[model samples]
Target chain A: MSTRWYPIYQRGNPQLRVFLPNFWMKLVRPTEEQPPNVVTFAVSTEMTKHDVKNYLEKIYKVPVVEVRTRIALGDTKRDQTYGYITKNDDVKIAYVTMPKTEAFKFPDLFEKKAEQLEKDEKSMDDSKEGFRKFLERNKKRPGTPGWFSI
Target chain B: MSSTLMKCLSLANTLRTATLRSLLTSQQKPTLAPWGAVVPALASHVQAVSGIHTSAASLGLMEFFDDPKVWSENEVKVGRAWKPDELRIKSNKELHQLWYILLKERNMLLTMEHECNDKMEVFPNPERIDKVKISMENLETVVRERNKAYHLLETGETGERPQRLVHNCFGLRYMYKSCEHVLPPFMNIKWIKSRNVGFGGRAVRKFLLQYREKLYNEKRKAKNRSRNEVMMILRRNPDFDLEVLRRQFPQVNIDKLRNEDKARGHYVPKIGV
Candidate 1:
């Protein structure tokens, strides 16, 4: 059953099964300190606490013990020049709790960016120095080709 | 001491042989279960047995890519997106299964794309995501078509959202989709009163008049500007194609425009010999 429509539950009817769920959940870093077993997620607005629980358990294979969700009000500000007000869309934040034994920490993806940049700059400098030396060696004989070198 | 050492060596040898035998027997057995028996066996054993192997091999999350080993490879080749004709032949159950697989693939692609952007690296074969998106859209369209047909057969309505033309407070027309409401229109006194405050007040009429005038003036000026431009072009180039100008500006009357004094070129025409 799609989340858009739900049939009324009868006593003897079978439980509903969602064949194609359209909900999406993105793991995000928490703005505040959180428990080691708790993870934050930005999920589809249509998703409920139960949906978040099932999504983590079934799709992500995470053992979700409990789920809590809240709608975060987006910021609103008046335009500096026009004086018209604008607001961003509200986002649904889901806090999924895994088993006590499980622990998760957001990995630092950009940790080595500075190091990589330093290495790149080093190589660039080396190439520039090599080209300068080559030019110095051929200063006297302008027409002489690079192949003439030892 | 010598007797004790000899006894320990014999025990170790026996243990070693037992371990070797068990290892050989385990190796002789199937490396893995055929995937059919791993899940609950269906009532129809023959159908389940045949379907399991085929579905296990071809369908589901397992077939999204070549394998884990191919992840580190520089390049991997795959066929084009699934054509509509090929998907049309599949059963509803199979199509449903394929939808989940595609959804998972799209998620995986999005994750990779996000990581690539974060790393400031060019995402390889970005078109692969587009192909998957197109395939999913086509699949959804096919499903929706079938759903609409089935609904029409069962129910009198088209099983789509009920919508009708509605006017807003500003008197602008828009389609309003009717949805389920907890209270009737009569009971909803606030809504009824708000809706009763219909548009087209004296103030609104004045505003609308100026707004319409503004639109009309812009259009009128644009048309006049284009007409003047056409005349200037004709005056500059007497040999200019009338058919091209006529096609270019459909609003201007080319025949009447050609006879105007402004349309005549600066140089005098030579008299007939």
Candidate 2:
């Protein structure tokens, strides 16, 4: 059956099952410090706690001991000069609890970023030095093209 | 002491070989390993599998994060979306599995984007999210088409929700999608009351008259704009092809417009040349 139109559930009717559920849930880094077993998630606004539980259990196979959800209001800002107001979409945040034995810590994604940036800076400096040396070499011959010597 | 050293060396060699063998076996049968471990090996099996995949154990919350290799990179290149034609040949089971895959990819992208924003870093290759979205849309469309075909063959009707053109209380006509109701039309008092609204008052008639006039004015202005454009083109290029101009602006009567005074160029016409 097409998920666009789900059959209404009446008493004594068979349970409704979603074959291709469009609901999306993203595991997000918690804004605050929490227990290791408690994970944060930003789920679709339409999804309930039960939906989040089932999604994790069935699809990702993540065992969930408990689920608590809250809809966080999106930020609203007024244009500084235009006097117009704009609002961001509100997100439903689901806090899932795993077994006490299951502990997860959000990994630092950009730990190597600083090192990479330093390496990039080093290369950039090398290029700049090379260009400076080329300019110095060509100082005597003002009209000489770069390809004339290199 | 020499015999003991030799025995220790031999025992360490056996341990190393045993670990190597286990690792090779795990890598060879990726389907038997955990979901996270199977990702690298799944590339070859993706084309061969036509049914649902019972992936090994989950990656826990770590599945939300991207691979560590790309975390520091400035760009991540990926292939394009799945086209409808490509999805059409696949069975429903494969499409369902693909949907979950796309969904996870989208979630991963979104999570990374959010995290990047939080860290004030650039989310590399943002177009990857759009690609995943396009694929999901195409997959849904293919599934809908199959559903429609099946319904038509078996039930003699498309299994789509019923909708009808309805005039609202504001006198604006719109397509109102009908939903399933527990009570019939006569039994549902609230629905009957909501749907019973009719537009008739003098105020509404005046509003509709003004609205129609506005629509007519827009149409008239568009026609005049096209006519003026054609006149300008003819004025600038007097020897312009009439057939091409006629095809370009079919609404503007090019034949009648050709002899108009406005269409005449500033230069004097070559008479009887």
Worst 10 residues of 1 chain A by lDDT: A1-10
Per-residue lDDT value at B248 in model 1: 93
Task: For each candidate in the order shown, give its overall lDDT on alpha carbons.
Answer: 0.64, 0.78
Could you give candidate 2's per-residue lDDT for residues B1-273 as a string of tens digits? Answer: 556546545543443344322533454322111122222223232122111112334565666777677788776644456779877876776677667777777787899998999899998888878878888899899999999999999999998888899999879999999888999899999999999989999999999999999999999999999999999999999899999998999999998998999999999889999
Q: What's model 1's interface RMSD, roughly to a tenth of an angstrom?
A: 6.7
**What C-alpha lDDT, on a 0 to 100 scale, does residue B222 get in candidate 1?**
98
What TM-score should be assigned to candidate 2? Answer: 0.83
List-wise, what DockQ does each model earn?
0.15, 0.58
What are the chain A TM-scores for all the models, listed individually?
0.74, 0.85
Quality of model 1 by C-alpha lDDT: 0.64
**Native contacts recovered, each model:** 0.07, 0.62
The total number of steric clashes, by the backbone 3 Å criterion, in model 2 comes to: 0
Estimate the TM-score of every prediction: 0.60, 0.83
The segments of candidate 1 whose C-alpha lies over 4 angstroms from its true place after superposition are: A1-20, A76-87, A111-150, B1-142, B149-157, B182-197, B269-273
